[model samples]
Target: MESGNTITIACAASKRTSLHGLDNIAAEGSEGYDNLINLVEDLHSMNVINSEESKELTNSIISKLKEEFNKDLDDSIIKIENWGAHIVRTINQDSWRLERLGSLLQGQGIIIMDWAMKFLPQRFREKQTD
Candidate 1:
């Protein structure tokens, strides 16, 4: 398989494994992974961006959640950098496939915007108070 396909398959497998783990955690009465699971589910629900692109996004989100969980500043910054570059490369491919990809990404974009609306202002306010 292509490297991209490998990453996609790996991501899907990892997501499944993590979610199953989260289910066990939930059964044990902890809700630590709920937000992460919700984010992954959102990515899974999207039909745009093929398996590879979806995996890229899913990995990015998982990395973000990892940063939140572990407070790994350096790794999280690297993930953010790579995520932006990957997105730019995808948008710049200038192909019919990407045009279709954009349509699917539009939905995900809206979700991001909603999150930004909720998250950014609260963060800004907290900074202001400090």
Candidate 2:
């Protein structure tokens, strides 16, 4: 939750769209939520990040469905300013964890490329290939 906490897109949200499963749920309240949860949880439990389904999901399925839903369903990525560089406020000397988001902070030259939002995992492979 930083300056723009718009990254959070939950199905139950009114103004925001859920990041996972793309189901039309405007008035179907309970049922819609249920379906969304099931879809999300099922996908989360899967090792499908690099699987074909995931690529198809982002490139075709989700892209097409997005245009179809329009508004009723809030499953779209909102328009907001995302700083090219993440914010790293502090550093954990004891833990290997990155305290915030501005590089290695310690200047250890550790590059943690986060492609989690990217539709293709091949992007990561290509980066490493370079």
lDDT of 1 by residue, 56-121 (tens): 766876676666556645766788999999788757654655565578744463222344446777
Error of 2 at 127 (Å): 68
In terms of lDDT, the poorest run of 10 residues in model 2 is 80-89
Task: Pull out the clashing pairs in model 2.
Answer: 17-74, 87-101, 88-101
Those runs of model 1 whose alpha carbons end farther than 4 Å from true positions after fitting are 1-46, 72-130
lDDT of 2: 0.44
Clash pairs, candidate 1, are none
Count: clashes, candidate 2: 3
